[model samples]
Target: MPMDWEAEFVFRAILIGVGATATMDIWAVVMKRAFGVPSLNYGFVGRWLGHMRHGQFAHESIAEAPPIAGEQIIGWSAHYVIGVIFAGLFLFVLGVDWARDPTLLPAVLFGIVTVSAPFFVMQPGMGLGFAAAKAPKSNIARLRSLIAHTSFGFGLFLATWSAAQVFQI
Candidate 1:
């Protein structure tokens, strides 16, 4: 019933979502290392520790340390994993068969929709408002957020395309 590139396989859509998430993680790491931008943070570790001590649930906070080689590796790995999982969920919702024929439109839209999870859970914990809305140094940061999300969407489409080719579906 869905418009997959192939009829017999829907796994390609899941592959696309996973690939896209991975692409974004890699890009984030490269940008952070090369351009001195901060990307993925493993603040969840710190947050969990905080909760254990305080017995109160708290949000994950962003790291304040300067990025280093090891940090980049660990952070980017986590980032990629998160992306893949999120995309995987979307693919599951779309149905494996339908995913085989994934169109850029749905995949990208899914990216946008999923971004809200980070906006609500991560952004505020990092001290930004819902969806990066309250971030100061406004103009550039806002533009950066917009571009980042858009890139994720594009990555999702690309991943889907690549998966389709690889799976021959």
Candidate 2:
């Protein structure tokens, strides 16, 4: 009972997403412990999303937004879901053949490219302005984002490479 290509693709995507996201989380933890750098509070993300139910898409300050019940859970879940979505997008753009024999450059480049989401969309929507222009420490926030996204790219390559080995893809 060998798995079909589609099924395998789904499994691989899930693995890659979770693995890459976990790698980002590990990096966050390391940054926090080593340099006292703070991580983005997913609670704010949840609150942002939660507000969508009330026809609110953007916030003046996500932090000042009223808390939504179970916002943390929602935000965390959304975070991983977004990761998985990105993985799927990566595969779609690169194709299944790439998954079978993954490379680093494309994965890392893609990860770096993904930073656009936060800089343009999420940041503005959360009231930080473009690329966190309104952030208290905008430059630091931008740099951290670049680093984090770069790590995510590395994670993508690592996950894909590992999956290729384990699954014999």
Candidate 3:
């Protein structure tokens, strides 16, 4: 029974992460097609990670940085991996009980908290300046990021609910 519980727990966490990430990606596509507001390309994320190997932690312009091999693959892979990691964190902090019952507030807060990585670490490292302050209409970019992250929170909750339904929990 313990082994079964552990397996279910691991499976559910991965499902939640993947489902939430898929939701976030869908939101990004909608934002791009509907608003003509482009989000940062994951290719750039790959580029940044690639550059990090050379000790280049910050870039003046990530776009201008020389392209790295397999950047798109690297970036996309990392994005999903990060999502899974966050989901794992959520499970770790809240425990198996939360996974069974689920709650909105915690999921939402976790999503919002996830923004710190991009806002402080990824944005600055990518040379977009703090919270994308250097981007055109920086406020808009920041707002979009917040909205997107919040959406991710919703995704997490939705995924958890879906899982609960499947397990009939």
lDDT by residue for model 1 (121-149), tens: 66665556577666666455655555566
Q: What is the Å distance of residue 107 in model 1 from its true position?
A: 1.2
lDDT of 2: 0.92
lDDT of 3: 0.88
Best candidate per lDDT, number?
A: 2
If scored against the real structure, what TM-score would every candidate get?
0.64, 0.96, 0.92
User: Judged by TM-score relative to the true structure, which candidate is superior, 2 or 3?
Assistant: 2
The per-prediction tally of clashing pairs is 4, 0, 0
- Cα-based lDDT for every prediction: 0.61, 0.92, 0.88
In angstroms, the error of model 2 at 77 is: 0.6
lDDT of 2 by residue, 1-169 (tens): 7788788778888999988888898999999999999999999989989999999999999999899999999999998898888998999889878988999999999999999999988889899999999999999999999999998999899999999998875
- Name model 2 segments beyond 4 Å from true: none
**What would the per-residue lDDT of candidate 3 be over residues 1-169, giving only the tens digit for each residue?**
2447667668878899998888889888998899887876899999999999999999999999999999999999998899888998888899868878889999999999998888999999998899998977889878888988988898899999888888753
Worst 10 residues of 1 by lDDT: 58-67
Clashing pairs in 2: none
